[model samples]
Target chain A: QQPVQSPQAVILREGEDAVINCSSSKALYSVHWYRQKHGEAPVFLMILLKGGEQKGHDKISASFNEKKQQSSLYLTASQLSYSGTYFCGSRKTGANSKLTFGKGITLSVRP
Target chain B: EAGVVQSPRYKIIEKKQPVAFWCNPISGHNTLYWYLQNLGQGPELLIRYENEEAVDDSQLPKDRFSAERLKGVDSTLKIQPAELGDSAVYLCASSATGELFFGEGSRLTVL
Candidate 1:
């Protein structure tokens, strides 16, 4: 099943913080985060595996809870370049390389 | 290392026409994926290939869509008799472990 994302959209000022959440009805093996600007590809941010792990990259971070089948992406001190659609993906158990993604959260960062 | 490569960058065609998108995964990566993204939405998996073998294609519309990965290196996604609803961005991604590297994507505009 496809994952669900919250706060469909968010507006943030430069240097502000924002969080996007994703949840699934079924168990998940891993969660991945990606950012996509207009007219561009979705860039990989990071991936959090099962075992309730949390990961950070630069000012962006994400946490995955295998027990709850949920994940949250945190963008700390957001920058103008952070304006984009963020997607959270759940890795299927047998299909290790296949990912099921959410509807996506739109993040707009103002100057 | 270079990222996944896809072409043509964009395509505009009338309804019922045929179109195809090509991709080349990163060297030595055994996993490849094709995802369809509608405007302002997250990408949905269309197919996943593991070294020329399509392991997951349940989401692909078999009636009008087909994909192939030859030599486990390059892949192609084709749409025959395209429909207006088919307009979207087609993203190609590759994975070595869990983190995926995406290509610029091929945008399809069905008129």
Candidate 2:
């Protein structure tokens, strides 16, 4: 099942902060985040395992609540290049489980 | 290392036709995935493969959609008798250690 994301769209000025949320009805094994620019491939941001172990790049931070089946992405001091559509995908069961993604949140950072 | 590669960046066809998209995941990545992304939406899982075997294809519409991963390196997704509703972008992604790397994606426009 697909997750649910809030704030379908958000616009922020440079140096501002924004938060995007994702929650799934089914239990989650892991939550993954990605960002995609217009006409470009989706780039990996981070992944949080059920036990809270996280692996990802810098410039962005995220938290996963295994008990609640929810996750949040934090963009602090947003930069112009941070503008993009953010997607949250979650796996419900095992390593072989497919990732189901939410509708996505559109973020725009203006100078 | 090269990222996932997909062919036919764009395709336009009339309804009731057939289309196929190809993908080559990064070398050494044992897991591959095909996703369908609609305009202004996140990518949804169509199928998943592990090595040369299909591990998950529950979301795929078997009536008109079929996929295969040969040698666990290259994969193809085909759609027959396409409908206007099938107009969307097909994304190919690969993962190892739980992180996904996506390709440029193939955009299909069924007129």
Candidate 3:
């Protein structure tokens, strides 16, 4: 099933912080985050597996809460390069299936 | 050394015409995925191939779209009698174990 993302769009100034949340109705084994600039393919960001784990990039981090069936992405001290669409994908256990994605959140970072 | 490769970075065709996009996945990658992204929207999975076998193609519009990955190295997605709504970016991605690497994508504009 496709996951759900909150705050469809957000505008931030440089050095600001923002959070995007994703929730799935079904249990998820892992969640992956990606970002895509206009006219480009999505780029892999980080992955959070079950067991309430977290993973991150340079200034971006994400946490997965198995009990809540949710994950949240945190962008700290955002940069202009962070302006893009963000998507969260989840893979359920027992299926060995491909990741299902949520509607992306559009983030615009301004100077 | 290289990411997923896609050919014909941009294509323009009239409605009802035929178009095809090709992809070459990373070496030793076992999984290949095709996704479609409409303007201002997130990517939606079209199909997934494990080696040369398509394991998940439920989201594909089989009536107008068809895909094949014959040798487990390269894949092609074709659209016949394309419609105006089919104008979007076609992204090809590959994965070795879990993480995905994306191509620049082929942008198709149907007139």
Best by DockQ: 2
Better DockQ candidate (1, 2): 2
Model 1 Cα lDDT, one tens digit per residue, B1-111: 788899999999999999999999999999999999988778889999989899999999999999999899999999998999999999999988887889999999999
lDDT of 1 at B46: 95
Error of 3 at B101 (Å): 1.2
Residue pairs with clashing backbones, model 3: none
Score candidate 2 by DockQ.
0.85
Error of 3 at B43 (Å): 1.1
* Each model's total of backbone clashes: 0, 0, 0
Each prediction's TM-score versus the true structure: 0.95, 0.95, 0.95
Off by over 4 Å in 1: A94-97
Arrange candidates by lDDT, highest first: which order?
3, 2, 1
List chain B TM-scores, each candidate: 0.98, 0.98, 0.98
Evaluate residue A7 in candidate 3 and report its C-alpha lDDT on the 0 to 100 scale.
91
Per-residue CA lDDT of model 3 for A1-111, tens digit only, reads 889999999999999999999999998989989998887788999888899988878999999999999999999999999999999989997324778889899999999
Q: In model 3, which regions exceed 4 Å deviation?
A: A94-96
- lDDT string, candidate 2, A1-111, tens digits: 889998899999999989899999889988989999999999999888898654435567898888788899988889999999999999988766788889999999999
On residues B1-111, what C-alpha lDDT tens digit does candidate 2 reach at each position? 888889999999999999999999999999999999999989988998989888888899999999998777999999998999999999999988888999999999999
